[model samples]
Target: MPRNTLIAGGVLVVLGVISYVASAFASVTALIPAFLGVVLVICGLIARKKPMLGVHVALVVALLGLVGTFMNVLKIGEVFAGTAERPLAVVVSAITFVLLLIYIALGVRSFVAARRWKKADAISQA
Candidate 1:
C-alpha cells in the first residue's frame, strides 16, 4: 500500500472504533453509519488504483454522510448535554431527522454508483 493509503486506512479504522465506542454512551446511534462510512473510505482508498468510478462515487457519498452525521450528533450532544429538558431534545431530534434525509439521499446515490461500477467490472472481466 502507498503511504497515503495506509494513513487513510488507519484513520478510517480509528474513526470506526471511536464511533462504535461513542455510540455505546450516546443517545444517538449515528455511530453505526459512521462505522460503515469508515469501511467505505477504507475500501475507496484500497480500490483507488482500479479506476472503478461507481465505487469512487460510493466512497465520496459515504464520506459526506459521515461528516454530516458527525455534525448532527455534535449539535444534539450540545443541546442535551446538561439538560433534562424535553423541548431541546425534540428540536434536536427534528434536526437530526432532517439531516438523516440528506444522508439517505446521498447513500442511495452511492449505492447506485457502486452497482454501476460492479456491472462495468463484470463486463470488463468477461
Candidate 2:
C-alpha cells in the first residue's frame, strides 16, 4: 500500500507539473495536485514506520482531494460538449478526482486484507 501510495503521488506530481507548464505558469492552481501529492508522498514515507497511522493519513488526504474535485465530474460533460470555459482545468480536476477515488478504493482493500490477516492470525494463536 505504501508503495502504491508513492506511485500515485508521483503520478499526481507529474500531472501538476505538466499542467502548470502547459499553462505557461500562469495558474498557481495548477499546482494543487502537486501539493496534494507531496502530502501523499509524506504519508507513504511515514507508513514505512507506522503503517496504520500513515495509511489513515493518506486516505484522509485522498478523500479530501476527491471531495474538492467532485464538481469537476459535472464539468467533464462540458468538456466533452466543447462548451467548457476551461476545458483543460476541468479535465485535470476530473482526472484528480478519479485518481483519488481509485486510491481510496485501494486503501479500503488494503484495510480489509489487513483485517482478515489479523483475524486469521488471532484464530491460529488461539
lDDT of each: 0.50, 0.90
Clashes of 2: 0
**Model 1 misplaced regions, further than 4 Å:** 1-6, 22-30, 52-55, 63-81, 84-126
lDDT per residue for candidate 1 within 5-89, as digits (tens), equals 3344345455545554554645444344444545555555655665455355444655565465454454554455654343333
Best by lDDT: 2
Residue 106 Cα positional deviation in candidate 2, in Å, after optimal superposition: 0.6
Please estimate how well model 1 matches the true structure, expressed as its whole-model Cα lDDT.
0.50
- How many residue pairs clash in all the candidates, one count each? 0, 0
